[model samples]
Target: MWTEGQDTCISLGVMVCVVLLTGMARVLVRRHTRSTFIRVFVAELLATFQLCCCSHELQVLNELRPDTPSWTLTVIYFLSLVHGLTLVGAVSNPCGVLEQLALEQMPVWLGFLKIFAQMFSSGLSRTFMVWVWSLGISSRHFAERSIKCASPIHIALPEAFLVEMLCSFIFHSTVMHFQEVRLKFRIHMQAALITFLVFAGGNLTGAIFNPALALSLHLQCFHELFYNYLIVYCLAPSLGIMLMVLMFIHFLPWLHNMNRIHKNE
Candidate 1:
């Protein structure tokens, strides 16, 4: 369904290709440079690159085949797969990075840096996307872009908050559980899980559990007041990250012990 002539299609291809190639070149250079700052900064850029790429690609696919559940799911699945396959551990969502920190996968300070990078990347990506599409503050497309913000629509504030928490918990828990799996299969599982969750919860709250991505949307797409957006989209998911950590730590030992016992017996 993606033709070569449309401006949207051209922009999507050009931006993704350029961003990916740039990131790849940086990674290669960092291999020799081996600087911590460079590594983390590039990592942040790569992750944000994927994050914003996913956001825009989703819009393109949705528009191409709007209201078709299968098509949308397929689009999500492919995008998630691409994220997984890329050698870079591109975590475009700040909530995801927080979950990583909870699992002790990365250092605290670097996590903060990555969050900033991701936020900046999201804004940059959105700006580029708007330019490509000829969207501006007064454009109808600009107004329609509010979906990026993860702000409440028909749902009330409390319900929106609760929904985000639950979705984040589900997503984080799944990631932790599958953390040890081989890469070949892990991304597929994650992609499937994301597709399932998005289908179920996307309409409710845009199904974004990433605080950084939400921040990008808030700034660029003019989401609701900062207070409201922070409360429902960012804070709720942050709590969910902590809750997932606790649940994992408490249950993981028991599960390991049971596995050990079964093997010995």
Candidate 2:
């Protein structure tokens, strides 16, 4: 009863379903076991999304600006580096706190390092997604341009990037706090205020603090052969670097000293 085109649609839907279900299962397993499964799942999901978004953006750009090379590429690459560094630093904060607690330790330097690593890790998560998405988009483009008529898919890169950033805020803000609570870190109004400020600042810079989102959205929006490389390698990385610097300021020497004392004991 289904036509050929309809069959293709069904297949795509099925694939998306499978991915979501798999991700859910991984989340549940991690919740129960407290293993590294959560980390792996988060990484894989982020990477795949980024690559797909990037691929689509690349396709979209080719159609929009056929002439002068758009500087979008440069912006996106720089963003990626900044995103990677900041995210890794932020996310690693919980892990550092945990490590400190486990050893009955408290070191300001270690705490700072942990926070830095976590933030950078977050950006790296985005980078992974962007690359994964890009690979898919590229292969699809190659097939369409080379073998058959090019598929015309309308992509909204900026919107997609914003959505992903919102998700990051939700996950990072609440889940991170939960981690702190479980680790028995003193929860204070000041901590909450600081966390809120950080999230707001991050979102203000660009909803997509992660390089992966930037790359995916950029690729989806503009895929001009001439400009594509610039966006991926340059613009994305720059953003990551900037983000890294901002997030690094959160680490304090006193925090590291406290952890070190406990760790040494």
Candidate 3:
């Protein structure tokens, strides 16, 4: 059995390798690809792959050291911040791509491509992680590989759906509202919000607000029915993003106009 320190180092090494390799791949793609579609596809694929690998590693580390909630929170926040800063020109979340489609900011075909890239990358990450664990570099990795699938959902299906929906709503709303904010500050705000959501909803549904991310981490688990995972993780988060977009585009302006008319009257 590896010591805790060795486990931590191995996890960190894995994350670092993923980040570096993704960065290199992205740079190569950008240099060689003139097609916008190809560039976007490569970007989305590498960014989402990096995200899923790091997130899965962190989750395994959390399980290994379950007693250190504060440590886990700190690491999550730091990783979120890193992702927000680094994922330039890439929409790693399928929900974000759908939101752009709804707003007509992205072509339908491009949005579909982005979503496909995200999902494909998610599956790749899952496979990659399984292979990494199979190497058994650390005792924790071996133990995690041997463990049977367990459901993250602890509540009823409806409640779990609501939890995921609320988390997605809050996250995307923040993203919408922070568009005018400076990048340095906006990324911090986003990271803080993600950290808070994960902390608050960690026990239920794994606080996964991204459909692609949920697919990568939980879709294959045997403890939950396929439909149940779809309802709570995939459908709910997408609906939440759509709801936020509708409110921002229509309801909020209508409410503001009504309030102004009442004041004028």
Q: Pick the candidate with the highest lDDT.
A: 3
Ranking by lDDT: 3, 1, 2
TM-score result, candidate 3: 0.95
Prediction RMSDs, each to the true structure: 4.9, 13.8, 1.7
| Residue 7 local lDDT, model 3 | 91
Please give, for residues 63-146, the per-residue lDDT of candidate 1 as tens digits: 655557787777678777877676355577788888788778899988888888888777776676566455432222343564
For model 3, how does the per-residue alpha-carbon lDDT over 1-265 read when each residue is reduced to its tens digit? 6789889888888988988898888778888889987898889999899999998899788877899988889988988888887797898999999888888998899999999999999999988998899888888776356246667899989999999999999998888888999999998999899999999998988899888888888755734478888888889999999899889988999999999999999
lDDT, model 1, position 152 = 33
Residue lDDT tens for model 2, 1-265: 4353453343334334434654565456557755443444454443344333333343333333335333334323432333232233123223324434433455566544444444444455445444443444322222233222231222344443334344344433444346445322323332343334334432333233334334333443334532533333234334333333334323454577779999999
Q: After superposition, how far is residue 216 of candidate 3 from its true place, in Å?
A: 0.9
Ranking by TM-score: 3, 1, 2
In candidate 2, position 244 carries an lDDT of 31
Off by over 4 Å in 2: 1-19, 31-33, 37-237, 240-265
**If both were scored by lDDT, which would come out higher, candidate 1 or candidate 3?**
3
**Predicted structure 1, TM vs. truth:** 0.79
Minimum summed lDDT over a 10-residue window in model 3 is located at 141-150
